[model samples]
Target: MAMEKTKETHPHTLGECTKSILPVRDALEVLSGKWKLPIIISLMFGNKRFSQIAKEVPGITDKMLSKELRELESNDLVKRTVYDSIPVVVEYSLTEYGHSLEIVIKTLRDWGVAHRKRMMVAE
Candidate 1:
């Protein structure tokens, strides 16, 4: 209650805080879960087939991968291409919008490495 009063006093600060939170929450909604980031990272290297993505991410079940890919595709973060030829080839790659995550992913990788080192040092 006190904090709400304080926030109300600073309308600009409250608006900024609320504005940032919704997008962050929405992003987390799309990127949450164990497999989504790994799958996205895999596609970052190059376009790949379903089996290839499975190989890269590792430990992810086929059903989960398919589900994740569909979600990613729906979000316009991944592009799925179907080639009409022998065996009907399909490939998955990052969309232009998806490439926007490059810096965010790099920052996460750096943070993860640092956190691991910090934990090891603490123990």
Candidate 2:
């Protein structure tokens, strides 16, 4: 049909592009924010307590950290573990699903380093 030919010839139309990029959109929906990636990066060192992550991330308020952690947990990117103790201890760590992001994180880090160098050279 003519419509089929048109679709094949113009594969990059808005609708087609949107479908092609839906995975990226979904990833961004989960990972696009000021704190999500940083929080994930912070946990890369190992499991950390709430206070520890806050200190490592720097400038994130308690409220913001709590909210972001909940989001990450809901997305299965982070796991929260609570221990029974006199005072009760809670720690956060990346889940197996979160560990799957290592490649993406490393790629971003490498690109960021190169970008910074490029900017410096431009200056």
Candidate 3:
């Protein structure tokens, strides 16, 4: 049976609610946790070495950074590159797909700034 498309005035179906939420849950899963967004923000400026990312996102341990980088790379959001040189060089950069988060990040930043000001005024 074809599911009826409800207008905004109509009550939503269980399937409608689940469909809406599932994608957001998946996005949050990929972007979740304390260090992931911070790492992404650091890489947004430019590519960096692992140590550089660790420095930029203060308080994240080397282990956590390494783990987070691996996850991001696995998700195809971050690219890891290696160079054949005197000493091996590894760099991390956001993939073009990752760069797609630019607007989302900016919107979050704006909301954060506004929320901070709102909270201050409320206090």
Candidate 4:
């Protein structure tokens, strides 16, 4: 004799739902704020100096860019390197851990495109 299998269950309690969403909350905590995502996208292209990142992300101030970059670096999502030269050069790039966000970013980009198209059609 064998035990009969029942259908799987979904979270039915508030605590269960909260527990299920903890990972998403944690990810958002690290990536939150207006500048973090765009900064990350800017860095995905390649290593770039501070000025380059500011230029790439429109409407961002030098101070804000510097602040956001520091936050990203502290979170292990971005790496900053300084080069030895006549003009001291510093560059920013994503870490291997940061590269893990590629798929998430791409998915958000795809959804955004589709959502914009849908909104245009509706309007």
Candidate 5:
């Protein structure tokens, strides 16, 4: 299936475009998970082993990490590579489609920092 281009430079932001798609339903479907975004963000840096990803993202259990990785792979957002050697190794990396989310993640992070500062100043 052809991936839809969600990015627009016009009057509306991607969130707005997403809203126009299905509003509550589609948004929830895309963002529904505790660890999806975190996992995606972690893989943005580059390919990483399962253990490395677990270390980079705190508070995620091995089972949950594996599950999340599988889901991401199924969604085509992440690619899994296996290496053959004395000790086999596997790594996960974001696909080109996943790289498109980098800007959105960075924007969200920036907004979060600004929001926290504002809240702290208000207190």
Candidate 6:
């Protein structure tokens, strides 16, 4: 048995290291979860109730949905409103900051669809 070592071909330049790392760090902070994207996509159309959002996004447990929504709300990307009535209604909508993410999300979705199609054809 022989051991093989791989060499690092792409070395990071000072500018490349800074520019490449910052966006990824920021993106991870904002979009770091299984349910984050789905939650954002659900709220894209408009405000939605907790139940409505959960229903619209399939396969998410009630607890997980609640948690992700709270996280987004805390990050200022999502707004939470509660209407005081006989039955309290809590609605979730995107803040201006969240709305700004629409383009990014759409781009990612488009890329994913194209990638999937290419993979299918290759198979």
Cα lDDT tens digits, model 3, 39-68, are: 999999999998899889989999999999
lDDT of 4 at 65: 95
lDDT of 3 at 24: 89
Residue pairs in steric clash, candidate 5? Answer: none
C-alpha displacement of 46 in model 6, angstroms? 1.4
Q: Give the per-residue lDDT digits (tens) of candidate 2, residues 1-123.
A: 455544455555647776869999989999998999999999998999999999999799999999999999999999999999979999999999999999999999999999999999998
- Between candidates 1 and 3, the one scoring higher on TM-score is 1
Residue-pair clash count for candidate 3: 0
Cα deviation at 78, candidate 3, in Å, is 0.3
How high is each candidate's TM-score? 0.86, 0.85, 0.83, 0.85, 0.76, 0.84
Who is ahead in lDDT, 2 or 6? 2
Candidate numbers sorted by lDDT from highest down: 2, 1, 3, 4, 6, 5
Off by over 4 Å in 6: 1-15
Scored against the true structure, residue 29 in model 6 reaches a CA lDDT of 88
3 versus 5: better lDDT goes to: 3
> Higher TM-score: candidate 4 or 6?
4
lDDT of 6 by residue, 1-123 (tens): 566565434565446667888998899888987899999999998899999998999899999998998899899999999999869989899999999989999999999999999999999
Which residue pairs clash in candidate 1? none
Clashes of each: 0, 0, 0, 0, 0, 0
Q: Which segments of candidate 1 are over 4 A away from where they belong?
A: 1-15
What range of 10 consecutive residues in model 1 has the weakest lDDT sum? 1-10
Encode model 4's per-residue lDDT on 12-104: one tens digit a residue.
544676787899999999998899999999989998999999899989999999999999999999999999887999989999999999999
Model 3: lDDT of residue 103: 91
Per-residue lDDT for 111 in model 5?
99
